[model samples]
Target: MNQLQSLKKITTVVADTGDIKFIQKYQPKDATTNPTLILQAINLSCYQNLIISAIKYAKLKGGNHQKKIVNASEKISVLIGSEILKYIPGKISTEVDARLSFNKEECIKKANSIIKMYEEEGINRSKILIKLAATWECIAAAKELKKNNINCNLTLLFSFAQARACAEAKVFLISPFVGRIYDWYKSKNPNEIYSVKKDPGVLSVRKIYKYYKENNYKTIIMGASFRRIEQILALAGCDYLTISPVLLKELENSLGVVDQILNNEKKYYKNNQSLSESEFRWHHNQDAMAVEKLSEGIRKFAKDQENLERILSKNF
Candidate 1:
């Protein structure tokens, strides 16, 4: 079997793209989008007409109410999300604005707003995972949203502290980044070549997965931000791996002897634990690489969001 076919036998593969064309081609179990992916998809030549149509629909709905077209940046995100949903069989993760990552109440409000937009399109709330960065406040917001039956995908997660807090909140899922974590380490030691077996990013995720499985935490570990096919295959049996189209295509074409690298058979007895708010802050602060990368991830997404808004405003 090809790597992609082999992967499906062990893991739930998710397409990490907003481009409908590629999404249809991969037909992953689920689909996810951030502001950055939405921005890139909307600008693609094949998706331009779709973007224009969504803008037109957004303008037509212009009003003084919550559904106003002036909110096209978010509205367009939903439009893209809805289109992708048509191609996938499972949930779609639509992210909250990265700017709201630190504001629990604002993140709560924005998450509901994004959900409301999806619901307005007649999409059921169950079909969407309101994605928020795995900041302490955002995790808190997700906890609150979960009370209201809103599922959340805690994203931009880099450290065990972030992952632990999200699990404590009983959030539906957490996307612990593998590539971004690897990138930070590589930049500091460019001459060192790392294999999938010893890759820092791969190891970081395995630690979390073992912890979660050992402790029986319910939060789904959806590994994200893969740098290479080896990284993806290294995490072969994560709960879910949201893969970019480039890597997805590579997996689809390559014939390989893929094996299940992760298993839940090992039980760890080290004190099953959770981080309190202060402990969470302290642990996150102590991890220099996580601190740097998490902040950079939020900033980059926020900037990409602004760029999307500018394009929407100028053209629409």
Candidate 2:
């Protein structure tokens, strides 16, 4: 078997794209999308009908111009996510506005709205994973959403504290950004030639995987945003790894031994403590890489979101 086929044997491979063609090609168990991806996908000819549908949806919904555009943006994302679900058996993570990351009430409101939209399309809530930024407020919103049976995927997760808080809040999944973390460390020490085993991003995911398993946190560790196949190979046995089509295509052709680097078996023991908001902030602050990357990721997503809104606005 090719490395992609072999890797799927141990890890749940999730397609990290908004494009239906790639998701259909890879046949990943699950699929995920962000504002950037959705924006990119909507421009393609294949999704033109979805855009037209969203424009009509916004017009019929009948709101002020800004409200109509916001509604249209949400509709486009849900429309794309619903289209994705037609091909994949597992859940599709539709993100709340990244602009709402810091607001607890708005986060919860937007999540419920997204879930409601999916339900209106005859997609059950069980098949949808509400994707949110891993801010303290988003985590808090997720905690409440969980009580109402809305599963969440906390993305842009960069620190141990973020993982701990999300798990304690009983989130369904947390995506640790492996590639971005690797990028940060590489930028700092550009001269150092880092091996796959010693890769900062791989090491970060390993640490999170070990901690979650050792503590028996039901929350899953999905190592996401990988830069190279080695990083994905190193995280072979993670709960899930959302890979882009580029890497997925590379893995499909490459022949190599894919080792299981992480396992559910817990070899070490330590007391796991829940973090208060202050503690979460302080601990996350201590890691400069995590802090910088998390902020940058959010800003990037937010900017893409605005770009998407502009597209929808033009349609109306």
Candidate 3:
């Protein structure tokens, strides 16, 4: 078996793209999307129909120019997610607008709106995982949404504090990014070459995986944003790994023995105590990489969201 087939034996592989063709090709159990990916897919000829549908939906909803554009952007997001859901058996994570990342109330409201739109499309809430930036306010919003049985996947997680808080809040999932973390460290030491095992990104996810399993936290850790197939191979037995299509194809071609590097049986350091919001903030602040990356991530997503809006507006 190729590495992809072997890896699937131990971990749930998820496709991290808005493009349905890749999702269908990889046949990942789940799929995830954000504005950046949606924007990329919108320019493709195949997705033009999805855009048209979103335009019609937005027009029928009836709002002012800005409101209509926002509505259409949201519609296209859900529409893409809805289309992807038909192929994958597990949930699809549709993100809340990153502009609302720090506003607890707006985040919650937007998540609910996404959920409602999915429901209207005949998709059950179970098949959708509302994604929010892993900000303190967004965590609070996720906590409330969880009470209503709206499972959330907190994205842009870069610190243990973020994971700890999400676990305490009983979030359904947390996507701790591997590639982005590696990129940050690599930027600092440009001349230094890091091995796969010593890669900071791989090490971070490993630490989080062991901590979650040791503490028996229900929040599943999905290692995402992979820069190379070696990182994916290193995390062969994680709960989930949302990989892009290019890396997924690489894994499919390479024939290798993928071992289970992570499992629940191993004992590791554990933090049983929950973090208060301030404590969480303080701990997260101490990590310079996390601080910068989290902020940078939010800004990038917000910009892509606006770009998606502009594309939607032009089509109308």
Candidate 4:
């Protein structure tokens, strides 16, 4: 088997794009979409109709152009997510607005609204995962959602505290960012860039994985935002990973052996321990890398979300 096939045996591969066309080619178990990916798709000629139709439907619902656009964007996201679910038997993670990252109640309300929209379109709620930023408020929102049996995929996770909190809340999954971590390290030490194995992003995910396994946390860790194939290869045995279609295609054509690099059994034998909230918080606060990277990830996503709204306002 090729590396992609081999990796699948150990980890659940997920496509991290809004483009439904390429999903079947990669045969990922799950798919994830954010505002940026949906915005990118809407700009394409092939996807222009999806946007136009959403806009028309929104206008018919009686709103100003800006309101119509916002409604349309939400509709477009739901449509893309639903389409993706048709290809994969697993869940499709659709994100809430990053702008609401700080608002716990608003985030929870929006997440439930999105899930309801999906259910209205005949999509099973069980097959749809609501994606949220890993803010304290967002984590709290996810905790409540979990009680309602609504699965969540926590994005922008960079610190162990975030992971511990999510795991403690018994969330469905957490997406620990990989590429953004590397970006931070490279910015700080331009003179001595690290290789893929030693890349800060790779290490961050590994550390989070080890902690999760050691504690017997049931919340799945899904590594996200990879910049290279090497980063993905390094995380061969993560619970799941959301890789872009570009990388997915590359892995498909490459001829290489992939082996399971992480094992729960091994980690359990090596100083396994659980962490209380205070311990987890102290450890995360002490790690300058996680502290800086988590802040950076939140800021970047917030900016991207603003940019997306700007684009929608101008066009819609």
Q: Output the number of the lDDT-best candidate.
A: 2
Judge candidate 4 at residue 307 and give its lDDT.
70
Order the candidate numbers by TM-score, best to worst. Answer: 2, 3, 1, 4
Stretches > 4 Å off in candidate 2 = 267-272
Clashing pairs counted in every model:
0, 0, 0, 0
RMSD over all Cα atoms, model 1: 2.3
Lowest summed lDDT across 10 adjacent residues in model 1 is found at 63-72
Model 3 — TM-score against the truth?
0.97
In model 1, which runs have C-alpha deviations exceeding 4 angstroms?
45-70, 266-273
For model 3, residues 1-316, the per-residue Cα lDDT tens digits are: 8999999999999999988788888999999998899889888787889889889999999878888899899988998999998899999999999999989999989999999999989999999999999999999999999898899999999998898899888899999999999999999999989789799999999988888888778898999999999899899899999999999999999998799998788565556678988899999999999999999999999999988887778766
Model 2 agreement with the true structure over 126-175: per-residue lDDT tens digits: 99999999999999999999999999999999998999999899899999
Error of 3 at 115 (Å): 0.6
Model 2 TM-score is 0.98
State residue 195's C-alpha deviation in candidate 4, in Å.
3.1
* Model 2 Cα shift for residue 30 (angstroms): 0.1
lDDT per model, in order? 0.88, 0.92, 0.91, 0.82
